[model samples]
Target: MQENKTSFSQRLTLLKQKEVKQTLVGILHGVERESLRINPDGGLAQTPHQAALGSALTHDFITTDFSESLLEFITPPEVSIDKTIGQLTDVHKFVLENIGEERLWSMSMPCFIESDDNIPIANYGSSNVGRMKSLYRVGLKNRYGSMMQAISGVHFNFSLPEAFWQEWLAKLGQEANKDTISAAYFALIRNYRRYCWIIPYLYGASPALCGSFIKGKLTSFEFSKIGKGTYYLPYATSLRMSDLGYTNSAQSGLNICYNQVDTYIDSLRKAISQPSVDYQRFNGKKDGQYQQLNGNVLQIENELYSPIRPKQPTRSLEKPTDALDDRGVNYIEVRALDVNPFSQIGIEANQFYFLDVFLLYCVTKPSEFFDSHLYQETETNLSEVVNRGREPNLHLTHKGESISLVDWALSLFSDLAEVAAELDEANNTNQYSAAVEVEKQKVLDPSLTPSARILKILLENNEDNGSFGLNLADTYKKQLLATDYQFMTADDLTAHAGRSVQKQLLVEQQDMQTFDEFLRSYFESSTELEQV
Candidate 1:
């Protein structure tokens, strides 16, 4: 452990040199936030994706996820965290102003869903690619049920700028090339997997949920009940990230390797191609309508359930793995964040600052290659943190030794503080270190964590999760609607909406092949990379 610490410190010191430090300013960040639209009564909205908001298939910043009511707001990559948050806020403001009589659900978990069928699958219009996109969601619904698909979260996209990569390559005495850069990212991923439990520990907010979420299902958790069918775990942090949410039993045995880009792409490709006995009953089609894209372990690479993923901007009609296979990793997406209910925009600027520091720490630290045992340990640690992170005296395995969660977190914070300081120095602002310090307080006092605060608010008010979330949704909705747009004008959004509709129509008109032909061509093109 001492040797590892020394190596990490040495590398960090090297990166903190003036030449390398200047490049750090260019690190880019973006966010994709998902939220369900709910009616005035707090029930999941049954309306289709708002047409005035723009085509779900062609919009650059707004779209639907699995459900038609599940709105996904995207922000373009920006070097400044404040600008990124501002852009996200502008998008939210535009959406709220357009969608009448509905509020965006404030929590990561869904609102009062009565049954699986109550959730409507997203529709993406008649273009081949668009239809295929909706069908993929159909596949998700058939495989995992719509209740699970209704859950929402935030995805953080991060990439180091080319200037930083150039400096980093020189610092490590490695060639400046795509492969080397990708290899460095994999090392960062390995470290991230080991310590990422701290994210949910600090920011996880779904400690309690409406019982409607699991209405007809049986769960093993010994849950405590609140007003009128709210279920909660007293010490839980993020039940949204637990086995109850966003998990795949079917892919539980998949051993996707992050040791190299090749291994990762190959594993996802195989998963998409491999047949599944469990999904075969769907037969891919029913009553002459396609029920799913295919009867495979995964219909496509996007179906793979993971907390983090290497990502590349895909070309039109290109598969994600194909893009990675062709160009290596461009950035990484962190998908474990629960929506911050307290924030009107579903995320806060300080969270981005803290993540910037933590991710830099992941890259600076020396990482060991993951073997099966180490991977299993990471899984165990994450499971422990998500389920019972706030429990006093909770111990997690660290390199085969049991360490108290608070102790381990404080140790990590010591290292994070150094990285945060370096980031603050690079950016000429104290926000990074301030963010780290704020998170450190949560580590010391679990009651300060978002998850604990959420449960406390619910219990103290004698309210159920549904009522608490509804109140927040209503509050945020009014606040967003009343606020003026900062980054985008209402007229600008309207013009973008008009352009997106035209783009969708052009795509539909340009389609020369039938849906069957399009699917066949897509699969053929996707698998042709196997020959390469």
Candidate 2:
């Protein structure tokens, strides 16, 4: 740990000398929250995408995640954290105005789901691409169950300025190219695996869940009874990130290498191409209706669920890997964050700043080559934190050795303090440092963590998962409706929605192939990753 401290300190000193503080970091933030409408009897809302939010297929900022009820709000990359948050808040405001009696679920986990058929799959318009999108989700529902598809979280898309990387490359005497930049980002991912468990330990809010979620699934742990049909681990942080969450047992054995782009792509390619005996039963159609996209382990690359991923925006009909192969990683998406139930918006600005620092720490710190054993170790540590993170003197593995969670978190924060200072110096604000201090307090006092706080509230209220989340949902809905849009005007938002609807109409009209032909071409097509 001392060696880790010294190495980061030296790197920070060099970074300061390069005077890269003014480099503007861009954030492409998006929040995906699944909610149920407040009907006479509380149940999952069976509603279509609201007309006010625009077409789910063509909207840039508003779309459905998996279910029609699951609203995902996206914000374009913005340097100003305030504007970024403001935009997201406005999206929520717009949505609330139109949802009528509906309320967004404050937590990451879903409410009391009756059955898989109760949840409606998201419907895109009548286009080949749109049909493909819906078919892929049908595949997900067939393979994993609709209940797991209802699980939602916020994705933090982060990218540093190219100038910052160019300066670092020059300082390190390395060539500046897509391959070099990508290698550096991969190194960052390696380090992220080493310490990202701290994220759920601090921000994980889904410690409990509705019993219906686990009704048909495996149940081996002891759970304290809340209200009717609700159970939670006494010290659990995020049951949503646990094995019971979005995990697929088939993909668990995949030892994907993140040390380079090619290795990562190769592993994903093989998984999607390889056939799985478990999924083969669902490969054929039922009554001449396609049950799934194909018999492969993964319907597509996007089916591969991970805590983090290297991302590049795809072109029309282009695959995720196609975009990545065409250009190196444009940004890294941090998918571990559970939507903060406390805030009206899914995330706070300070939370964004904290993540920015943490990601920067991952890239700047020295990273060793990661392997299968270490990757599984990362999963083990994360499971421990998610299931029993608040347990006194909890232990986690670091580089194959046991260390107290608090000790490791504190040591990591020490390095982050320096990072915050440097970023503040560059940005001419103390917000980054202030955010670091706030997170530091979470590590120092476990009670201050969001997971702990949520558990405490539940215990005090004697409320179950459904009742507690419903209460928060009502509160947030009222708050959002009361507030006006801060970033964009109401008319501007409506105009964007209208235009997106028009765009979807145009795409439907321009379709050249049948859904069947399009699906076949997509699978049989030989798409190659662009080499540098």
Candidate 3:
């Protein structure tokens, strides 16, 4: 590890000599924000997606995640992080104006959903693609239950510009090709796995939940009872990332490798194509409705849930893996960020800059192949942090040795400081190092962390996740509604909404194949492979 760190330093010095620091690395950023719509009474909003928000099926920036009540707003990739944030803010303002007495839930956990049946699955129109999207959600609900589907968070999409990659390859005297680029990304993913446990420790905001959420199942852990039904682990960080969040017994056994793009894709491809006997019970349709697409372990590539994923934007009607096979990774999605209840935009500028630094550190440092043993270690480390990150002098295993979590995190911050400084120099701004400094404080003082702050607020309010989150939601709602929409004009957004609706209609009108035939063709075409 010491040698690896030195190697990174040497690479930095070489790049510095080449004046790579002067190049403005295009740090493209976008955000996917998922929030459940809650009624004025703090219960799940039973209404359909508001028409004013545009057609969920065709809108580029706005869509539904798993359920109709869960609104997901996306922003276009922007060189400026503030521009991306501003776009998200504008989308939220637009939705709030049209939602009418409903508020977006501010936290990752759902707000007072009474029953699974009460949760509304997102509806798409008559087109086969739209229908497929809806049916995919149905499969998810049948597998994971509606309660889990209602949980929401923010996903950060990030990528480095082509020029930056080209410059790095030149510095290394390596050819710029898809294979080499993909290998570099896989290296980043490997390092990300090793250090990803730090993410939940810093940004985790879901430390507690309403009593209604758990419903008295799995009462093994000590939980603080604040209200009649609120339950929380005192030292917890992100319960959202814990086993209680997303789990599948069958999928757990699939130890997919991240050592190379081919290995990763082949593993996922097998899972999606392979049928699982566990899901067979729910495979057949009853009463003119399909229970699920098939008894496969995963019906599609999107079903594989991970904290981080290498991604390439797919062409129309293209499978995710197919896109990766054809083109190298376009960006990586950071999916573990809990919606910060304290902020109106769900994430802060400092958090974005810190993520940039963290990701850069991951890519620059040496990475080892991720095997089954390392996979379990990463999983265990994340679980430990999510449950008891704030415990005094907490320890976690690294390279088969136990070490203090705080000590390890502080050490990593030292490396991150260098990366931040270089990034700051390239951008000619102090923002990067300022962001690192803020996160460093969180490592030194856990109470300043989002999870700790959430617990503190809950303790003050009698341990009520629902009421506390709802109040914050309402406050943010007012604040966002009052703010000016700077990135886009109201007319421009409305026109975009109208255009999306027209596009959905066009899709519906142009469909020539039956739903079953369309499904068959899609699966058959996507599963076809070129001879190696």
lDDT of 1 by residue, 243-359 (tens): 899888888777888778888888778888899999988765778888887788887777888889998887776678878878888999998899998898889988999999999
Model 3 TM: 0.96
Clashes of each: 0, 1, 0
**Candidate 2 structure, TM-score to reference:** 0.95
CA deviation > 4 Å runs, candidate 3: 1-6, 527-532
**Tens digits of per-residue lDDT for model 2 on 1-532?**
0112336667777678734555544334444444444432356789888898899898977888788888788888777878888888888888788777877777788888888998898898788777767877788899889989898788888887788777776666677678777777887888888888999988998889998888877767888888777888988888888878877888877676787888888888888888888888987678977888888888778778788999887776667776777798888888888979888777887898898888888877977777777888888998899899989999998878999999999999999988888778777789889999998998889899888888788788887878877777888888888897898878888999999999999989998888777667766784421110
- Which model is ahead, 1 or 2, in terms of TM-score? 1
RMSD of 1: 2.6
Q: Order of all candidates by TM-score, from best down to worst?
A: 1, 3, 2
Ranking by lDDT: 1, 3, 2
Measured on C-alpha atoms, candidate 1 has an lDDT of 0.88
Can you write out model 3's per-residue Cα lDDT over 1-532, one digit (the tens) per residue? 1113347787667545535566546778899999999998889999999898889998988888888899999998998888988998999998998899999999997888777888999998888888888888888888878888888888988887777778776677777688777877888888888899899899999888877777746646777788766778989998888777855656886767788899999998888888887777887678877777778998777778788899888768777888899997888999888888778878888889999989978877877777688878888888899899999999998988999999999989998998888998888899999999999999999999998998888788675888888888899999999999989877888899999999999999999999888878877776421110
Candidate 1, 113: how far from true, in Å? 0.9
Off by over 4 Å in 1: 1-6, 527-532
